[model samples]
Target chain A: MISTASAVIGSRVSVGHRMLALTWLISPLLLLATWALVAASGHYSAQLLIPPADVWHTFKDLLHSGELLEGAAFSLRRLASGFVLGASGGLLFGAALALSKTVEVYCAPMFHVLRQVPSIALIPMFILVFGVEETFKVLLVTKAVFFPVALATSEGIKAIPRSHFEVARLYRLPRYSLLLDVVFPAAAPPILTGLRVGLTRAWMVLVAAELLAADSGLGQMIEMGRQMMRIDVVMVGVITIGLIGFVLDSSLRLLERRLFRWKAIKE
Target chain B: MNASLDQRWLASTSHSPGALQIRELSKHYLLDGQPMEVLKGIDLRVKPGEFVSIVGASGCGKSSLLRLIAGLESDYSGDMQLDGKAITTTSLERGIVFQDHRLFPWKTVAQNIAIALKRSPLTRQEKALRVAEHIRLVNLQGFENAYPHQLSGGMAQRAAIARALITQPKLLLLDEPFGALDALTRISMQRELQRIWVQHRSTMIMVTHDVEEALYLGDRVIVMDARPGRIKYEIDVDLPHPRERHAPRLQELKEILLTELAGSDADK
Candidate 1:
């Protein structure tokens, strides 16, 4: 009975420890409460700053009518398809550049210049080439996702210690086996970080594309609400986009943890 | 089959006058169109099963010679024959342990050892058993799942030893594997290496700047002078494996190495 009590106390201590570790989570809640207070005070006009209660009501109405759900699903699908293709292509291309001196020498300068041009800056060119269609949105996401992943992969591969390469040679690890077993694992953590950054950037770009031209998606829904002067609906759309982005970043972080358990074991 | 291979390894080292025969080995480094000769017509031989330690001042090409034998550097002129086979690129038949543990941070202890076995034709069960056996040989049981970071410097090095031995190589080359360790740990690891070497009986060649370390573990100590390194002198330690640190023969060799290194420094 005494041991059980001690176990209960131990669990409580661990819970307290977790709460302390996650102290940053309180800031967003505080910001939300402050926004509600500012809206209630009517310091800004209602059109510019809708009360949280009204936003909540509009959010519920949109949820009931399934408009928000449909819009979110559409945006998510476009994000996934474009980001996957872009990130995978970037990974392979980056590995090639890092592994081969000739490839790096020939391609590096052009890639460097191209990466500086922001994805949003290319929207007009994309529109001119592909027109204002599904292709344009996907291409925008692809552009956003590609550079970070490529840069991360190249840098990560280069950062691997020379000693490790010597070890690989000493083992006479076959070409494919060396890549699969040593090179990829050594490169994964940074590549995963790049993927997370690329994904979030692509998500933001997709929303911008939808805002500019798309017929459906949360960003377009917000544009429609703005045109109709339904500020509450626009507010709901903004909140949902932010929340979804947060969830995506968190989940990618979880996967990184799983893949890099060996790092933690060493620590 | 295993017994026969071990027997052959023993016989080859015993019957042959030299375990390693290097004749007219030369290496030149080119910098900005200037050719600098690092090793100039070096001729050396290590007798079978002899624990030879090579010592030299920094930039004396001691490490470069070891690298040539380890098959890390192929751009050299000469013949380096081990047990009558010309040394080329790395082979499973030869093993090396470096100063750093060099264990992959992503792999567990068992996984790291298993990587060395991947190219071998051994069955999966046999590989697992051999890996476990080597781990025990290095006294690292119950650490099968531990990552490299989880181990202390000494333990990680021991794991590295196990990985090298897993291939059952004919020759073991150590390039200052304990240099990065603390003084206390270095002594203990030296003792551990002595014990392990006694048990395995492989032809071991270790390189170190520490004269005492070279004297304590080596059967024959070869001292090299500084500029464009070459063998200056050799002292034979007739003491057996797991030899006492305070043994009269070891003490004599230790004093000789100290005076040689000190005399070389004074000459410079």
Candidate 2:
């Protein structure tokens, strides 16, 4: 009876320990404390360094005025459109590059070189051509998203083992089944990783594009805050941007598990 | 006399349609742009509901022979037929299992088995039922939801066998299916395979390096020489299904095969 009872408690202890792991939050708390301490030290001017409470007030003000919502909606709309457009194109282009020798031979070198030219570097040229309109920002995000996803999808398809294709052939699986069941799943992990990278990278690039020239967005709000010397508003925008990136990354990480679950085995 | 008559009755059944006939089959590989003989003048015949095991050295192209019969490659020159139809590109009539259990890691055991029925005419309900039946056929009933990575080597191989047999192919080819297993697992799997053969009575061709295994399970064991693989000889096991493991006939055949194999290697 004692042993059984102890085993029950032992199992519960693991759950209890998981709850206790909230101590991990202390790291972020330490960073906040450091920020507050530096502000209190009065080394920097008031315009440059506003305390955490003032930033919280500015957050509340922005929230109540509906500017935060409007800015977030604008940025997310850009993110969604750019991500969908680029990711689908990347999927098709990557599969083509993997499937056709001629396409690969002709396009692969140029693709590598072009992707190396950062989307941020293209921002000025894009503005000069496309103007400060939404086209410039959205296109910048699309370019940022396209490269990683395409590279990952092509490399993932190439890495599938030859034996698998042979098995598909032996069974005479239909082309649809061969792609959906075998090809897609076989190449999923890397492709999904590429998508997540593309998503986060697009977010960063879009924000930078907005800050450089856009009339509205979290980036524009931050630029306005900087222009008006509202350090507290600038802090709020920075915090919100970091928070959005974290949420996007964490959500995709959740979807990572939804895609496939293969436990690693040594053998 | 009765056993021979029973075998004749089994062979003459029209319901079993896995009869294979091969003649003058030869395969060549371009190693460094020079055509090297992989298989030379190979001839073979298999009756319906028969289990034929081929044992050979590494370079004997036993695996290549299985692949050709599977219709995965057409580079070989041969007159190969299955159930009176010329072997063309891959067809649903043939199935194959490799040394490695090639279960897709992302798919569960049931999904892996069901995918074999992609071209099947069964409805979704029927496919599910067949998947369940095959799971039980391999004694993996509770592990239907388990992924490939969650299974042991032996269990995974059993699942592979289930997947291969689910389509009810005319012929099933196993290329060193149990070679990667441990000694104890290999023995158990051999027993399991024998049981499956006895129950289903499907035509099967297994390629292995183990002489004991070939003699134990096969109705006939064909030995081949390497470096331009050619069938040296074949031995008729002449035993009924589920024979005793320690049968003297099996031991005798093992000795003869061992001697012939070693002598063949020495001639090289």
Model 1, which residues run further than 4 Å from truth?
A1-26, A264-267, B1-18, B30-37
Model 1 over residues B1-268: C-alpha lDDT tens digits? 4997566444422211237889988898887999877777778887766788988887778888888888999998889998899998888777889898999999999999889887888898878877877787778999999999889999999999888878777788898989999999999999998887776677788989888888889988888876667778888878777777787877777887888888988988
Against the correct fold, how does model 1 do in TM-score?
0.90
TM-scores of the candidates in the order shown? 0.90, 0.92
Give residue A127's lDDT in candidate 1 (0 to 100). Answer: 91
CAPRI-style grade of the A/B interface in model 2: medium
TM of chain B, each: 0.90, 0.94
iRMS of each prediction in angstroms? 1.0, 1.3
List of clashing residue pairs for candidate 2 = none
Docking class of 1: medium
lDDT of 2 by residue, B10-100 (tens): 4422124499999999999999999999999999999998899999888999998998899887888979999889997888788888999
Model 1 residue pairs with clashes: none
Where's the lowest-lDDT run of ten residues in candidate 2 chain B?
A: B8-17
| DockQ for all candidate structures vs. native | 0.70, 0.70
